[model samples]
Every structure is written in C-alpha cells, then in structure tokens.
Target chain A: MQPVQPLQSVTSAHTDRSLQLTLFIVSLVTASVLGLIVLFIFRETLPALSGPGMLRFVTDESWHPLENQFGMLPMLWGTLASTALAIFLATPLGIGAALFCRYFAPRPIVRPFRALITLLAGISSVVFGFWGLTVLVPLIARFEPPGASLLAASLILTIMILPTVALMSEAAINSVPESYSGGAAALGLSKGATIRQVILPAAKSGIFAAVILATARALGETMAVLMVSGNVVQTPGSLFDPIRTLTANIALEMAYATQFHRSTLFVSGLVLTFVIAALAIAAHRVEHRAGSHHAA
Target chain B: MQPDSSVSCAPGLMAAPSVAGSTLLTAQVHAKLSERLFVAAVWLAAALVAASFLWIVADIAFHGFAKLSWSFLTEAPRSSGRKGGISTILVSTLLILAVTVAVAVPLGVGVAVWLSEFSRRSSRTARVINIALDVLAGIPSIVFGLFGNAFFCVFLGLGFSIVSGGLTLACMALPILIRATESGLSAVPHDWRQGAAALGLSKAAALWHVLLPAAAPAITAGLLLGIGRAVAETAALVFTSGYVDRMPESLMDSGRSLAVHIYDLSMNVSGGDQAAYASALVLIGLLIVINAVAIQLSNRFMKSRIQPA
Candidate 1:
C-alpha cells in the first residue's frame, strides 16, 4: 500500500508539471506572435522612413506614388475627421440607449434588447459598406454630385460603431454598484435624476473606455470606409467632398504596390498601430484612476 | 433684470411670503420640465437604436435578398467576379474558418485555464499577459494583413496561400477566445470546485469532468464569435490569400474569400454591381443566421444548467 501511494503521488506531480508547461507554452506563443508582428511591420517600414523621415511622410500633402511623393496629411485629416464624426454621432445615442435600458426598460425586455445590440455588433463591416454604397451614397448624392463622399463615409461609420458603443456603455452601467442607486432612491430622487446624476457619473470611466475603443475601431476600419470615402488622396473640404483615410489607403494600394510604395504602406500600418496603442494606454489610465477612486 | 431684483427682494421679505411661494412653485416646475425632457431623450435614444438596426437590416435585405440563387451559392465566379458565382470564395472562407478554429481553441483554452485555475489575479505574469492581450485585441485587422504579408507570405515561404491566411486569422481570434473562456471559467461557482474535492476527486479529474462541462456553453459561444470574425475578415486575407478566384486544390494554393470577392467586384470590376449585391446578400444572410443560432444555443444551455442546479 505504501509503495502504491508513492507511485500515485509521483504520477500526479508529473501531470501537474506537464499541464503548467503546456499552458506556459501557449502563453509564450501568443506573446511571440504579438511581438513578431510588431517587429515585421517595423522592419519592412524602415526603407520608407530612411528616405522621407517621419515628419515629411505626415506633413506633405502630395501623395503621388508615381513621383516619389508620399505626404499623408490629407489622408490623416480624412481619418481623423471621419473617426471624430463617428464618435460624435455614436456617443449620445449610445449613452442614451444604455441609460434607457438601466432605468426605464422592464426586466423582461432588457435581455432581448441587449441581444439585439449584440446582433448589430456581429454584422460584418463589409455589409455596412455595401449598404453605404447602395443606400447611403445615393442619399448623399441628393445634395452632392457623387454620393461617395466623406459624409457618406462618416454616416456609415457612425452606424457601424453604434453597437460597440451601446453594448459597452450598457455593460458599464450595469457594473455600477446597486448601492449607489439605492442611496439616490433614499434621497427621494426620481429615477431619471438618479440615472443622470449618480449612475452615469459612476460609470464615467467605463463610458470613456467605450468611446476610446470605438474610436480605435472607427480609425482602423478599412473596407466600409474604403467603399464609401471615394478612394481619392485629397483633403476633404466639406462633408460633401470625398477623402481617403490611412486604413483605406493601405488596403487600396497593397495589391500592386512595389518597392517604396509597398514600404510606405507598411509605414502607414506602423503609424496606425502606434496611434491605437496610445489610445489603449490612455484608456488603461482612465480605468486605473477610476479603480483607485472606487477603492478609496 | 428688474424681475431678478424683485425675486431677490421677495426672498428677503417677511411681508410677501406669497411671492416666495410663487418662486418655489416656478422652481419646481422648471425641475419637472427638465426631468421630463431627459426622460423623453432616453426613450428617443432607445428607439433610435432599435430603428437604426432595423433600417440597416431592411436595407441590405431589400437590395441583396432577391439576387440569391442556387448557382450563386455553388459556381465559381466568372468575368472578374462580376458575372457568375461565389462558390469558390465560400469554400475558401470555410477553409480559413476551419484552420482558425483548430489552432485557436486549444491554445486559447489552455491559456484561460492557466489564468483562471492556476495563476492569481494579482500575479505579475498574469498582469503582463492580460496587458499583452489588451494590445492584441486593440490591433486593427489591416496590421494583421501586413504582418501576414511579411511574416507568412514572404518570410515563412507560404507565399499568399490559404495556410498563410489561416494562420494569421488564428492569431487574430486568440484574444477573443481566451477572454471568453476566462469569463466562463470565472462564472462557475466556487462551491462546485469544493464539491468535487469533497468527493475525493483529483484536481485534474475535477476540472475535466466538472468545470469544463460547466463552462462548455460559454466556450462554445466564444468559438462561434471567433468564427464570425474570421468569416467577416477581409484585409487580413487580402495579402495572405492572394485574392485568386479559384477553388483551392491544396493548403498552399491562394484563394479569395467572400469579403474580398465583394470588395474586388465593387471597387474594381466595372458594371459588376448586381453580382456584388448578390454576394453581399448571401454573406450577410449567412452571418445573421450564425449569430442567431449562437445566441439561441447559449441561452438554451444556460436555461438547462440553471434549472438542474
């Protein structure tokens, strides 16, 4: 019996060690994949950086790949403007929907309501682009000559990002402790007042995180904005004018781009990655500050 | 200005309590009006959300649904994907999904198990891994495409093949799967673990027989969501998959996906609008069905689990 017990213990220990080793390998693989992707993009983008320097790539508006000019200011403005428009359009509606779900919607209706938003989130961006091409572009053409302009792109992006913002804000609102609302109730505040003053403020950090995530998503969006934003390399003057974004530029030219053209696309990818990382860090700080405030 | 002075003076007056009463009444009315406005705004917002969803679905269905047909689902595209069918791209999409699922599930689940069962939340290793995942999740799909182009297509000699695209997609799906599995594992009540231990079960046996089964529904949901992302992906497959319109004869052959096919026809193929619409309809319809089925299955599993317990 003693010998059998010793053997059993040894086998269990061995199994435990193997399980940990397997999990460690998985983590290592995931981390390496992330690191390798960054390294590859950086490595491939070096040639473009060598000739132009980083500032010239961003500041110059002449993006004729034929003439060796790769100024990206127009596209940068296009991306920033469209993403800003998306955030502006999505935030009010998203927060409003979340507040409605938290305060006004009955218990029986909330689940289906959430499921609907999740469904919206799952729809592919290409389909949104398709809708924009067929429906939105034509509608915008009523005011503008060609419908595929920055306005159409911004409108499609607004819809594409709506679900993400709505769902995240809902989750944030739900995560707020019930005790805060209870105190509001005890103070004789109306449900509307409680939601506006207490719950929304408490969920501010999560709401901010949601907006930043949505911004990152809108900026990185390619196919839908590509389809609607006219694919031109000019800075848009009005909502009616067509423009290209950094992401759309990469996808539009990658197929046939060679040499410096190819490297420039990779440089654009590198810049977009840095921008997203910056937003993520900002979000993390916001969350950390909110967490400490809660702990206090 | 005179009214403001009169109001202030009334507040100080002991003789004109009626003026103060009227001022309090107006203040109450003002509060009520603003509260009503906010309530109205919330209702309008909710309605807008619902309406926007319906509007998009209806618009797509109206334009694309009629174009769906039998050959459209089964035949290879012709005329630069402007004339015939999307069967080849459909096949390629499924192939990519298969490879992504096969690679991501084991690694993601393993990482989740390690994080949930072995490591403390406060551990430095766990924290770093979490931050790494945060970065991964935030990365745009185009970057994945570029990496796939350089690392898989060029560096690894896969050279714009289905295998290259599949591996890139697998990397993209990892963060979603790991996060889902972790949440599912965390959702399992603590008592279940203690109960297994009390029954004299080993830790390995308990996890295999008890906790894993309990988390199956959530893990399944995660898998379906990952599949949805893989199916919807375009930019990542563009460079790695080479946008060829043929049915892949082998893993190394380059192929087009439905999303890329739609892009090519719409953006490049002149006079190909109808074909593009038909493909979009098929793709969107398939995605909706997948999402509905996932939600239904997860809900049913939750119901069954909760009732028995």
Candidate 2:
C-alpha cells in the first residue's frame, strides 16, 4: 500500500508539470502567430521592393499593371485623405454623443443607448457598405455624376467608426473621478462649465487615444471602402473625385494579380500593417500615460 | 451690497439691485443661456447618433423584410444571387465558424488559464504576451487575408478553402478570446483556490470542477463575440476562402462566406440588389441574435453570482 501510494503521487506530480508546460506552449502561439504574420507579409513584399527598387513604387503616381507602372502614391493619398476626412467628420459627433450620454442623458435610457451603440458597432462592415451603395450613393449621385466616390467612402467610414469613438470616449469620460465634478460644483461652476473646464481636461488624453484608435480603424477598413469607393487608381483633387485606398487596392487586385502585381499588392498590405501598428502603439502609449496620471 | 451678496449666495438665484447688479445679472444670464445651448447641442448629437442607427435598421428591414421567406432561408443562391436562398452559404458560414471556435476556444482558454493562474502579473513573459495580444487585436482583417493567402493558401497548400479561412479567423479571434477569458478566470475569488488547496484537490481538478464553471459565462460571451466577428468578416475570407458560390463539398473545397457573398452580390453582380438586401438582412439578424444571447447569458450569470446560496 505504501509503495502504490508513492507511485501514484509521482505520476500526479509528473502530470501536473506536463500540464503547465503544455499550457505555456499554447500561450506562446499568441506571440508566434503575430510574428509569423509579420514575417510572411514582409517576405511577400520583398519581391516588389527589390524588383522595383522601392523608389519607383514610392515616387510614381499611376498604378497600371500591364504597362509595368506600379506607383502607390495615389492609393496612399486616398487612404490618408479618406481616413482624415472620416476622423474629422466623426470626432465632433462622437465626442458630443459621449458627453450627452454621460452628463445629459436621462439615467434610465443610458444603458439602452449604450447597447444600441454596441449593436451598431457589431453590424458587419459589408452591410454598412451595402447600405451606402444602395442608399447613400444614389443620394450623392443626385448631386454628382458618379455616386460612388471618395466622399461616399468617407461617409460610410464615418458611420462605421462612430460607435467606436463614442463608446471609447464615453468610457474615458466615465473614468474621470466623480470627485472632479464635486470639486467643480464646490467652486460654484455651472454644470456645463464644470464638464468643459474640469472633466474634459482630465479626460483629454483618453479621448485623444480613442480618436487615434478610431483613425487606425478607418485606415484599415477594407470591404466597406472597397464596395463604396470608386476603385479609381488616382489621387483625388476633390472630395467628390473617385479614389482607391491602399486596402481597397489590395482587395480588388489580389484576385487576379500575378507575380509583380501581386507582390505590389503585398507591399500595400505591408504598408497598411506598419501604419496601423504605429497608430496602435501610439494609442497604447497615450492610454498608458492617462492611466498613470489617474493613478498619481 | 446686493451684488456682493448675490455673488456669495447660490449662483442660481438672481436678486434685483442697482447698476452694478444689473451688469452682473446679465453676465450670469448669458452664462446660463450658453449652458442651455451647449446642452441642447449635445442632445442633438446624441439624437443624430440614434437616428442614424434607426435609419439603417429601418431601411434594411423595409427593403429586405418582404423578400425573406422559408425558401430564401433554405435554398442555394442561383443566377449570381439574383434568385434563390442562402442555405449553402449558411452552411459554409456555420462550418467555418465551427472550425474557428474549435481551434480558438481551447487555445484561448489554455493561454488564459496559464496567464491568470500560473504567471505573475508583472512577469516579463506575461508582459510580452499581453503586448503581442494587443497588437494582434488591432491588426486589420485585410492583412490577415493577405497572410492567409500567402501562408495558408500557398505555403501550407491548403488552397482557398474553408479550412484555410477558418484557421485565419482563429488567429484573428484568439487575442480577444484570450483577453476575455483571462479576465474572467482572474475574477474568480482567491478563497476558492485556497479552499481547493486545503481539500487536497489537484490543480487540474479544481480548475475543471470549480474555476471553469464560474468563468463559463465570460468564456461564452467571448466565444459569441468571436463568432460575431467571424460571421461579419468579408475581407479576411474572400482571399482565404475563395469566392466559389457553389456548395462546398468539404473543408478543402472553397466556400463563400455570407459577408463575401453580400460583397459580391452588391458590388459585382448587376441586378442582384434584392438578394443582396435579403442576405444583408439575414446577416444583421444573426448578429443581433448572437449579441442578445450574450447579453442575456452574462446578465443571468451575474445575477446568479450575486445571489446568496
């Protein structure tokens, strides 16, 4: 009986050690998957970068595949333009809605209103694009010749990102200590004055981080932008002009692109990955600083 | 004296007085007016946000609700989705979602258990893993499409099939699942662990019998969230899964997900708008149901947790 008990304990201890090791290996997949994605995407981009010497891809403006012209400036411009426009349009409305929900909204409706926002966030991007195509495009076409343009894409993007911005901003505003408002009230400040002067300042970094993250989302949006944007490979001179963003370019061309053209699309993907990574890191840093400031 | 007294008193009150008092009263009134305007403006913004949500839902329902029928839900799309139902697409979507959940849940739960139960919060490895998960969560789906295309389709020889798409989505879903599950596990009371140790229960037994059930609600919520994300995905699946609308014979055969089908019908197919509307309606309905269930489950679990035995 004593010998059997000793063997049983040894086996159980061995199993426990193995279980921990197995889980540790499983956890490593999180980091490895990310590493593999970066590695694979970078490897695919090497062909285009090395073949075109990187200069032509950057400096050239047109992206005709058969002619061997692979300039990404126009797509780059489109991505930057549409993302900036969407952020510009969404920021005020989102922040305002956040302020309303936190400070002005009736207490009973707040939870439902937030759930509504979450639902909006969960709606598929393709659905938003389809709606834009079916509804928004026609409305725009009433005023312009082609309804599908950079403007339509930006508008759809604005709607898609509105929930993200609003939710995050609401959370930011909520995080500002209640004591801050109490302090303002003690100083005899108006409710509006207190919100604007005290709460907003305290939540500024968090709100800024939220907007930055939303910008990254707008920049990375593909299917909706692909569906609504005219997919014209040109730098738009006006908001109404047709344009193709980097993401749209990759999605549209990757289906049939071969060798060089395919590699170029990979290059576009690589560029997007880098930009998004940078934005995410920046947002994280800002959020971290805000958190530390609050703790202090 | 009146002006000074008014200043000292609650700002809401206005007392009648002489010339200096009148100016002060006007200033206070102006501030009050601006405050009213600002609040009104904020209310307008919130109203606009709500209005847009209504507009989208109403428009989709108005246009697509009439087209939905028993046939629409059960038949395979025909004529580039100009006619017929989305039965096959539904199958493919479920299958892909199944593969995604199967692959992601175990791995995610394992990582979560390791992080919450084994690793210290301030450990270097834990920090690295957290950062990696953060970056992974932020990566765009289209990039995942590129990687899936390059690695899974070409390098792995999986081709453009459901398996490829599912694995890609599993990668995309892992970070969110892990984060949610980790938080859930961490939320379990320390006393429970101490009790399990005092009882001489093995770590695995305690986790299986005690910790997992407590965290089940959160894990389920995370799973539903991942499913919602996978169902809504278009860019990631299009390249990884390929765009063949025919019923996929197996995991190896390319299958078009609902999102990708909607994209193709609306963007590429002429005269496919009615079907696109129907498909979009179905897609949105599925998401709402998933979200509602998650909310209900979590709420019920929370209430149960709060109740004394």
- Candidate 2 lDDT over B1-309, as tens digits, reads 334634633486656666667667677777889899989889988898899888988999888888889999999999988999999899999888988998999999999999998889899998888878888888999999999999999999999999999999999999878977886787788888888877666687788998888899988988888899999999999999988888888999999899998999988899999898889999999998887777677667666663222
lDDT of 1 by residue, A102-215 (tens): 778889988888788878888878888878887889888987768899888888888888887888888788878879999988776767778888998999998898899899
TM-score of each: 0.93, 0.95
For every model shown, the clashing-pair count is: 0, 0
lDDT of each: 0.84, 0.88
Q: Candidate 2's error at B9, in angstroms?
A: 11
Cα displacement (angstroms), candidate 1, residue B64, comes to: 2.2
Residue range B128-236, candidate 1, lDDT tens digits: 8887888888889999999999999999999989889999999999988898788778878888988887765667777899988888888888888888888888888
**Model 2: runs farther than 4 Å from truth?**
A1-10, B1-10, B13-19, B299-309
Considering every candidate listed, which one attains the maximal DockQ?
2
Over A72-101, each residue of candidate 2 has an lDDT whose tens digit, in order, gives 899889999999999998998899989988
